[model samples]
Target: MTDIIIDGGTLTASRQDRVVRGLLLPYREECRSNIGRFSFAPGVVEIPQDLTGMSLNIEHERERVVGAVTELRETPAGILATFSIAKTPAGDAALSDIEAGRRVHLSAEVAGVKVKDGKGIAGSLFAAGLVEKPAFPSATLLAAEDTSDDEDDPQGGDDTETTHSESEYVDEDGNVWRMVVDTETETDGDTTTTTTTVVEEVTENPDETTDTEEEEDPMPATLAAKAKTPTPPRGRTRQRPSIADDLPTLYATVAQARAGDQQALTLLAALTDTKISGTGALPGAGVLQESWQGQLWQGKSYDRKYINQGTLGTNISAAGKSGFKMARGTKASPKTKLGGDWAGNKTELPTGTANAEKFGSTLARWAFAGDIAREFFDLPGGAELIEAMFRLIAEDYAIWSDEKALATFLKLAGAPVAPKTYPSEYNDSLGMLLQGILAVKRAKDEPSFAIVNSTAYEQLLYTPHEKVPEFVSFDITTELRGTADAGKVYVVEAADSYFVDADDDPLVDEGEPAVLVGAKAGVEFDELGEVPFTIDALEIAKGGVDRATHGYLQTFEIRPESFVLIGSAPVVGG
Candidate 1:
């Protein structure tokens, strides 16, 4: 029998392989065999654990001891020696030129060949030397050897596995057994089959039977192996189900789309726009404008009016008789009455150069980084950008817009000059507000709305805390844009009310100024067939090269009211 030898080991720079030296050889104990004193496994030996200060004699020459053996251990093959080079001048020079890797050639010797009584050839490692550097990949630790049954392990010594024939003659005390074999037959008007077989002795001695150990064949390298999928046997898919009846419906729908619906055209346009815009956002740009999403009128420019606010007709609910009476002397008729421009008599919308700006970076990188289009509407600043554009316009508008509606509502409320330079807390401040509401009701016979800044509204909210006598308990009904228990003083909150610093009207320089407005008092925003406030995209460029991502807002006839100035507190230092 030939001995098995594996010649690979590890020597890391850390010098940590001490007990691992036992891996180089199979581990077995010494035993007193019938032949004499010897070991069942010869390579097993006690090895030194620490050799920290011991020097290594390269090829048994003390003159070449460049490094010290820091650690050593007994392994299956031989003792593992871990060493490190000294940091001396000579050691450093030697290490600098020495190539590093571990797979040294080791010498081995066998004692004798026998089975029982330890007669089998026992392999033993004798000498180990560092020769040429190894070419194969190395690891920090040695691999565990295949420890299957000696006769069955694929490494060597096995040939018991077979499958072909079912029966063969065996004169073993009337016992029957299956014999596996293959046969071939040739015919020239004659047939023949041939096979190979061997007979074994029924031995009771262990030493004699040990010689029958079989060797296993090596595996083929070219074949790929995988776990077999489990399934119920006796099943096969031979045919497919039929669905020919549904074809007519599909064809009819296609034909209908081609002739009537123009679905192909719609699909083409949608796909083209999506590709060009690269904005495959979800259904809507989900933005949270909870303050005022659907509060105001959302209609086309044609739905608004840009005519004179002072001359606008009040005949919305004016009554007249277009029907004639029978047998009446000249059929009694009454003329339709029109009211003068009592509200917004001089509330003029000023026209100036439109101010606009853009603040967005190029989306070229984000657009090309991913294959899918990102939904901009879902982003933090996505759809809100449209609202932001309008808000910018509204901010400037709030600064200079006339307060015609406010003044008109106040006059109807009998508080025409109630907003004095130093008006009482709720006496005139809140009283004038409620009175104006009631006056509009008396004159127009309809309810009136007042819009104020959030700051002034907050004050009204804490009016009772300000030690006021009129306010019992005012509640902010943001949803209704008014107060709950405010009786007739219905107030609305303007998110962008404090957008300006101070009003330049010169009427009053009071610190806080507020504007009050009615629903039907302001001029209208109208265009031929477009929305009053529209958001459009522009491909801005400087020298014919598209520069940045920008948006445009088109607002028409957007005139705010003439802001009213609030009175400062009474000076107590008399």
Candidate 2:
């Protein structure tokens, strides 16, 4: 059994806001903890000045950080903080437990503690945890209702009250107060709130008031009246149209709908209650992908340029200029007379030079074709099932493109770039990236982008390094974890780099930016014959093929001198 602590602690969590806010330590309130009786005063315990990255875990598990402390302040209640929960599964579960009136205790993991005379003194809160049973029983988690979710909402648009709940609290004087808030809304958009707080004498057993269960229920009159209203019987009202009934029909005709089947198209129109086009072209991947930009990877690869052909040449001229120089020494400066013939003392300047390099790009064809049995369309949820399949294929394609681009970048670099080692004071991932950027700057190029695996990026987010200039942009993708090692950072000068779609030329009159005038990725086209070609073979008798063929033609160019690859990217994957 875990020891419990009760030191006038208080905590509240708001699932809608994704935040857990409460008193961390009860100042001047003595509490019995697992380590015996301990309490804190204003100056007894020291906390981090900035609680920016403090982890909030579960059951004191160091590895399962579910949230981070976003706000903290010292108050009469001891230390108060607002923790923003992460969107991970554990985080969601913890918040749900809190909202559902479970796992109501919070435990503080303090470090550097010096216990003197049964009191903890001079310690820092290293982190906090959400536990089923905490050493401090008063550190209970309360469901904080969003007042804005009620009427009295300042937004004024909706008069309908959205939420109603009751909560209890223990004041410093040990008075138990039950708070009931009633929000009434009218059709005219008027909002009002009635709050009633009933105080009760401190009972012999504080657990009766502190525990969420076995507590007195102070029902608000307004809420009681609303609850007393008889609920209408289910299904007596007219039902709204739902697409569930037509799912089978839609699935059966989905492929034919894309192939311009009149019967299939008509059924789909009636099912969806909207007219679909007769052009034989159902919504392509673009429809589902539009919300994520042209291609998922391209959104992150912003430093892109376009070219029409597979081969291109670039010329880099030498920086130094050639010019005639006169003798500069005091003795030889005036040796040549103005009117004299060409003299031997005149010095000739070296000739300027430039280097030209031609590079060719080859198109890599990637196609995703998924086949579903013809009978699948007749099954429930087949439409969604097929879409999910294609979605996975699309995601795989995105990862492949991302890895391919990283590989191309690494290949252009020819060798791993080592940033100038920084002093111990500036030793961090962000510092390394800064040094890498400096290296690129020394090459007469500007470092505009940095690419790192998601793991490295997360470290960069918390690294205590000097502020990076606004011009330098950093991006993270999981694919980089495979291409570039998780701990590696790749800083590059990609302003002039381009992703070239060499398939077709741009229309000069369209006024499209030259950078965007090319065939984008995620394109679907038929084979030499109609896509999902009808097979006269016996396999057709089993069930017709349900296939989607998607392919794109594109290549990219990153000049050898335009990028600097920093950190370790193990050459392992194909």
Candidate 3:
């Protein structure tokens, strides 16, 4: 009987003569026999088939089975095997050839085969796709291998045992088995020795098997590859709705408002009240003058008339002892009189005075009045009124001083003028006073004092006197008018005129006789005499040409006076 020794962990078988039959065989038949509950560890497994004295060649180009065969078993039906295959050209080709029903035969004289746990035959055969159905039974079983001194034996002689607490499997013989081996190597001299030990448990029961799935990798998605698109950010929009469709109505409403429609004011008031607070007093408050105006008028109390008037109104005169005496005596007299008269006569005076007194009173009341009074009026205008009164006083003093200067100048100049009468000329002191008053008024009215003729006063002061012109006359004779061609040219004799000066020397005794020439062009003479002088042809031609008709000539001379040339030239075409 010829026994097929499969010393390698697993082996594959196929019928060489019938490829279809071999292909039809189950994969379990491809496993080695007597592999009994095998284990894969850190090292390799070797199975040697004795082909002594027999020539045998195995085609292992198919790569279905390569690298370490994880498990090998024999059953009643067929061989069962599993391998951890390597991706190599020869292994792939061997698997392919086996799957195609290529058969490998052992030697005729060869005995049964035995597999060892070693690096050489086990690693090479398994890497060559001789095994089927590879598996990793446990973490320990993942590194199991065989190493023994059995050179001739097909299987590696024996396996080195490992010490570990957890056993991966238990066989029918009650021996605990491990699945994985961790190998370590030591070399002494030229020989190298390797030792491997099982490290973890393994299980074959399908129900008890633990599935360890790898973690999911996080790969970045491209912008184009993402499934969902991102939404754009929200933008701000105007609160009001567009009036495009009702533009005409809107324009009509605006026009009506501009024309002072009452409804517009009502609408504005409503909108303002709702959208803006404290706008009710705006219209009335805008028209109200500042309290400072009143305060400024109060400052004018320093004036003699204003003070006198204030005294008269508030003072009580004692007709009996020593002329008139103040009711409050000398000390309080001025204060009482000024204050009382300011209060009483304020309404009778000019608006400026009344405003000033009102401002002063407002300030005084705020500063001196009881807290009860302050609370009653709320004192809102107190500070403003005080400021106004001070301004009014300052402005009034300025006006009074200017007027006083004018009065003094007028008295010195002997003008018995009343305060009401204003001077017109800038030379008068009264005029300066009026100017000051007018300037202040203009400043208040125009704010900028812009409409003043700045040079008027200077021009009035430096006006120049007009000079009188000297009168003289000359006579011309009919013989002096010598004629040339009527339309072309003519010559007028030059006439000389002179004015006698009493201071001038006699003509015979004169240093150089004063030459008198005619004002008309092209005529010259030494002295003014009754004699006729010759004129040029060009002058005669110029004199004959009408300025209106010739367009370029301006004037002509006719002895005594210059004449304006007029009349049009005859049209040649017409």
Candidate 4:
């Protein structure tokens, strides 16, 4: 069998009273498998829903049951379920491993699957396994608390949970049989289906009941109500709009407050909902006065961008140079040892010429601006509104600047690596990343990092790989524009800009979807003049002020050989 590899999150434990909780199955999360890419939507798993009696096993082995699911609820993120660890030695060990950071993730086992568009649209969650590696990054084992004070209580602590029970008895053939019974009931319309999983673990010696190995029956006992009519295929279900769905119009609110409208000012104050100071400024003055200039303070936020010349490569001052020049060295042999014919005869050394080229950066002005009516200055929240507008523009510019940086880098990265088409047989994004890293290494530069769009990054987390090279790291950006282009990732030695796509025309086979790479030192970003937030009163007739943030990005030197662009087949149903 082909080996499975996955990239994702780590299991973490935190003290939260006596109960253990975590995200069980993340909804709409896709993962790459040996067969291909797959994921589970909210309705895929069919069960009693609460999964009260669902067993928790080790590596999907039902016979090695360690615990049972006690509670479950559907959450926006996914299904959040709680587990009741059994009191057996195996259960104790599993719990100990989880709390000690030994056992890391959870993997769900399902049966009777109905797949559509690479997702488990319909299936049954038979059991969940505690494994070292899991397919879903969000399938975390958050915490496991031992409810039983007496860790060695053999009755398995009947007082805490009644979802499942175990009993042992000797058969006529002098064999010990351990019976695990799970009970659950659910009603769909008028019909109710009751499921009971009775697993038998056989052992020759009663003392070895815990050590004995067994396999669960291929099919569990399920009682179904007779159908009165054939059911139709499931279709899309409608969801009610949520309270947060009603988005507020911040621009309108700010505009009205600037006109000295009391109602608008009150509404704005309520929306901001903070201490307000009426110093002829906008309501909730503190928040409106927050500054977003000079630095990317929101860099840690997922929506904010942090990539730039300095981040990917060396950032240097323009130093007043219109263009930078460098020589491309041609391969030449070293001089032969000066032996035998030393003084009189001299042999000509291998000669090679170096090509000199000059490269210059491009300068472009970028800013975000807003216009406010003059009357807004009369209201207390008016100044606050102006400050808020400036903050919004600054945040927007920060994100846009990164997108421009990435687009420029892709253009200058040059052609894609040789044999660029990722292996068609493998639907693994992580594999494609590994290929890109190797390609950069072949170019004689150790890859420093890689960047992929958010979509491709999700694929990477699900695509199972033996191991990701420790030498390089992965970075994700929302700015890697284009739907089809999102499937590609670039491995780099550093960074540069002004990219030329390797393939002008792409095919369904996934060759050259998009190319982006280069050395950072090769690119120069010069912010000319001050990026000041300025406000100017408009013409008297207009009676408004134009607020803008002004700055220019100038100069760059690109080195194509320092980066490799890897592309994969666009994921189906993505």
Candidate 5:
């Protein structure tokens, strides 16, 4: 009780790449499709050959489609006929179905057919309804048969033979006065006569010569399997892949890492953009940090040893006084002198190892669900997710480094910076900072950069300071540095200035916002390993459940003496 078509009609894929449907097909083959149920078998139907390249209203709608027969194959079920919608004005309506992966019924004019397996003339095929989708064929899969078998006959070529020829002639008057004559003369008493006949047929190639049962037999285990094209290969069509059925998958990078080979590591780098150097205890959050100059320090701290700014006192003291008289040849107490005094007095280096407060971050924000990890790996945005994680790790490292430096700064700035005397109260911040920068410039032998809060910067902006005329507000990374007034004052953001309380709430009054100053080498950022900033993941046993611990080890230092802040510095773990 569905719409029954006696001839050319729809087919259903047995799996992804195969289908068995045709006119005069065998069995009561049924298929599920969006177009509804459409059955095809031979009936008393007649299809005209003239309609082979013509259009038909297979849509069963207003528009008619030009149906072009793609192939008429002898299938295991029966004759499998496949057709495509021609590119025409009316065919567009039918093509929409094909493009949408929707099946359409084939309206065929079957004629002069009697039985289910009987063959007859099929006039035109029109796609009518919708159905499930199927896969297209590869070149080798469509191969039907081979036909490179035509060879020349043995005795059909040029060869000499001994024979005689005779002829009879009659007048146009129809009087049988036949005259007989020998047409061949004796070639040394031997003559040759040869006759050849050849017959060939001009076939339209309609018959399905290749009877493919079911694609092909699987390759045996004994032989190496390969693809082969038929000597008379079937035509291969280019069909786009179906996006709906495409399923993405996750690469087993984590599993591959177990191998620990160069190739495995390389693949991990390509996927995660990071290579594992070694494994150790992930550093805990603390005050001690490595500086940009790659040295260990606590806060805005530095190291200095007793170095003779100039030469100290001599290795021996003057053998004067009572010692000279009592002991003439004895070694005297050695002492070094300051610039204009005795050698005994010594002074410490201006800068010494001031602090070693631990400062770092522990990456603990993790979605403990393993399913989340799987999702990140399997989703289309997996690469982006991984990249974002890497960036956050770097940012976190920089942030903690900055905080440590700020803490050092708060300690170094005088107890009473005693608001400097200036024309405007607000504008005084600029003058105060300029005085600090001038000192840093003298010590470091180069001008330094500064960072302050937006409010402080606004104060500087209102300053009537005329010396910084060629000024512009821009970041250091801006490309047009040459055009900027290098001698003028500028500010950078103190990335780690904010502090939070135990509740993870930003503290309203930890201290005044900070202003940091640094030269290229003024701040030391000690790196612990070759790759200080790295991605780390591990499985931790917590509460009897396995959880992944993803963290970073970015060890760096920032000198506190280089920065100035208005508020108290945030302590570690704040």
Candidate 6:
């Protein structure tokens, strides 16, 4: 015989025959019913002595048949049997039918002997092998008994509670078999007393057994004790203040008012009026008052008496009145106050000395004209003009011995002499004139000629001339009123135009107008079209031939004027 432990319990079987017989009986009955044959109830039938091994056959109603068997066991009570079963079919119909909770029948056989209802028979045999029954509390019965005790006690004494607590039990399998809690309350004089008792049943593994099951570590005694105690009274959680809940209709009313509903506004006004009456002041009243009295009223006229008369309009009216009075009191002609008449009449004003003083002022104004012109035109020639004017004055002073003449010359030259070397009044006037000239020049696309001088001419002419290569080496000639000396008049004969090419010939007709070559690495021509040439040499053939030679052969030829070549080298004879 072999001993076997069931799930947390023990059993025994003595022989293989008994084990097989015990397991197959239930399945045999199931097969009989499934095949539509005689129904059979499985019972304690002895295993056939000829049996070798156990087998099960499951037959689906309209499908196929399948089966499996538990491994044979020998225990003190009988064979302890456990196994799984499934369906066999060409399709998955048997499995699908089983999963859908359809009933299936299974048959069991040991060797040549068949048993009925094997599953039920085996389950009963396994149950009979347990050495002891598992103990568990009946929760419903316990609760009912406690209620009955409380009812019996009426006032509820501590003795009944203690008796309920002491009836708890625990087992060695870590299962709580029973637990009870009891409370009693007593009052005397001005004091009230309450007592509570709790009992729990706990199970732990035996010391001789190795505990494969995990144990929950005990909580700290204080913590466990605290957990068993009742909680103290506390007020309910506070609710958050919700704008929507407190003022349910406020948002909707605002939306309606915005849609031009006057009822909402009227309601709001009534509410405000009621609040104002209760408090003697409206909310935001100061803001409303300021908005109406200061902002809104100030934006519009309250009365015509306080309306503004603009400063410009008043000034214009005063000016008109003064103009009218002056027109009536004086003659129709506008008179020059300095003794020059409006009519063709010259007044007998101050003579020589007075005239000289007046003339001096005029000359001073004129002398500053150059500075004014330079500033107005934005030209560097302002200083040049002033210098020229001063030079003229100095020359005049040297020629004329009279102080008055010298003074007059200085005035006309616009060079202030003495006390004010540069006149402040003239300086301001010059600045204004300079601005005006610059404005005119910008609009007209023409240079201001107000302060022309040699430096100015040189800048305008030569500066631009440098941009045109043809004019770079040209001896420009202009007619002179005096000397005709070769050095002074005609230094060397040359055209203000020239050709540019890789060779001296310029690869163009000699009679053609000069073509300008751009700074880009290619030669361009106005009359002939683009020339395919490189600047290999430049030659000055004075009073002779200008030509180019390739190797020993003449490639091009040209006639020459007074020779001068500024760039490249001279080509030998062609």
What TM-score would candidate 2 get against the native? 0.29
lDDT by residue (1-574, candidate 2, tens digit) is 1112232233467777787765566554445432334466666666787777788876666698999988655543356556899998998998888777676555666655554654556667657767665333334324445454544536755455433333455444444433322333343434343322211112323543543333432222322212322221221111111112233443454466457665532210001112334454466445544352322333442222111111222221122112222332234243323332444566554333333334433454566554567655667756666655666666655555444554454445444444455666643556556665566567665444454433344555554524544544444344321122323323322221222213222111121111110011211111122211222222376675646544333443534555555544234341
Per-residue lDDT for 31-150 in model 6, tens only?
Answer: 211111211232332343333233332221122223234443322112323233333352244333333334221122221122232222222222111111211111111211222132
Score each candidate by Cα lDDT: 0.31, 0.45, 0.25, 0.47, 0.32, 0.25
Q: What is the C-alpha lDDT profile of model 4 across 1-574, one tens digit per residue?
A: 1112222222222233222334455555555342344556655565555665688777655689887877554433345445677777997788678777777566555555444555556656555666666554333323323232213235543221213434444434445534343434444445554444434345464453443344433223333343222122222221111122111453464456557655443211001212456654446535656664534455443342325432332232445335544453532533333234334357555444454456655666676566778777766756876776676666666666666666555555444543344565444455555666566567665444465444445555554444444443444335432121222333322222222233433212332223233344545555534443464657577887776676455546455666656544344465
> What does candidate 1 score on TM?
0.27
Off by over 4 Å in 6: 1-54, 60-65, 72-81, 84-93, 109-574
User: For residues 1-574, could you state the per-residue lDDT of candidate 5 as single tens digits?
Assistant: 0122322233322222222222223212322111222223332222333435533344333244444554443322233344554556645645555434464333333222121221222222322222222111110011121111223435554333221111121222221211111111111124333221111111122353442223323111110022222122222211112123111211243244345533333211001112223332235445337554422343532111111111112222122111111212223432232234344458544321222234431221211122135445446766565555454544444444455444433333323233345454335456555555655565543434555554455555555545342332333333211122455444554333333323445322343433434343333323223222333344333322222323222222233344333333344475
What is the C-alpha local distance difference test score of candidate 2? 0.45
What TM-score does each of the candidates earn? 0.27, 0.29, 0.15, 0.36, 0.28, 0.12
RMSD to the hidden true structure, all candidates: 26.6, 32.4, 44.2, 31.7, 26.0, 39.1
lDDT tens digits, residue span 103-194, model 3: 22111111322223311122212222232232211111122222322223234443332211222334333224332222233333454444
Q: Candidate 1: misplaced stretches above 4 Å?
A: 1-68, 71-74, 77-429, 438-447, 463-475, 478-480, 483-490, 495-574
Higher-TM-score candidate of 1 and 4: 4
| Residue range 1-574, candidate 1, lDDT tens digits | 2222222233323222111111122222122212222223433333334444455333323465556554444422233343465566755544333323333221112222232342224443322322223211111123222111113435443233211222222222322222121211222123222222211112122333333333322111111122222221221111111112234533453465557654322111001122322265434454423465633554322111112222233221112112222221222432233233444668754322322322221110110011111233446655465455455444333322223323333333221233443345563445435544444454443333455555455656655546543432344654535543323334655543222333422222233434353434322311122112333333234212221222212112111232222333223342
Q: Best TM-score goes to which candidate?
A: 4
Runs with alpha carbons beyond 4 Å of true place in candidate 2? 1-357, 378-380, 454-458, 465-539, 568-574
